[model samples]
Target: MTTEQHIRHRADGSIDTAFYTSQGRTRRSEAAHSMARGVIGPLVILFSFGTLVALLV
Candidate 1:
């Protein structure tokens, strides 16, 4: 990654949402992964809890 990729804000002081770096994926892919995690993480937890409760009951 280049030094220019470290910018976290726009020139107008708005938060930049496109910021992502390649650990093992490109910036775009990383952003998508983050969004998926945010949406799916809650559902996964809910499903796991439901499964455990069903087993116990």
Candidate 2:
């Protein structure tokens, strides 16, 4: 059995490192925003509840 190795070549005959790096950075930014929202959403909910309770009392 012969093993085959996959090779990638860009149209310009140069390595497309920048394109892959940019994609990775974009994904990382998206993950960070998702995490921030997860934390901030709950805090906002709690704050609103506290404010309403205080006003009623």
Candidate 3:
């Protein structure tokens, strides 16, 4: 995800491997947020497809 895009780079042709925890968000919260963001799109698409099939039937 683009969540790490900001932290994944440095301007001096090196990777930024050092990360500090809980900059207003814990690792758990960040993971849950990422999971929800990932799931919502597919769930919406799947449900909409199901609804369309049901209506057609």
Candidate 4:
């Protein structure tokens, strides 16, 4: 039950966050991209819907 063992035992796969060079980017970059998309996608939709509603009013 040590820290390293606990981290390595996640339900997902390996806990190591190191990125493979074959992928051409680090895991940190991937996580950032995912987070940006998650935030931006909703914001864009909300803005478009609001603009449409405003035009109708």
- Which number leads on TM-score? 2
**Model 3 C-alpha RMSD to native:** 10.7
Candidate 3 stretches with Cα past 4 Å from truth are 1-30
Predicted candidate 4 versus true structure: per-residue lDDT over 1-57, tens digit per residue: 656534433356765454434344666689899999999999999999999999999
**TM-scores for every candidate against the unseen true structure:** 0.52, 0.75, 0.45, 0.54
Index of the highest-lDDT prediction: 2
lDDT of 3 at 17: 48
lDDT value, residue 32 of candidate 2: 100
State each model's CA lDDT, in order.
0.78, 0.90, 0.75, 0.74
Off by over 4 Å in 4: 1-25
* Model 4 lDDT on a 0 to 1 scale: 0.74
lDDT, residue 20, candidate 3? 43
**Candidate 1 residues 1-57, lDDT tens each?**
646555577688976655533333576687999999999999999999999999999
Error of 1 at 10 (Å): 26
Model 3 lDDT-worst window of ten: 16-25
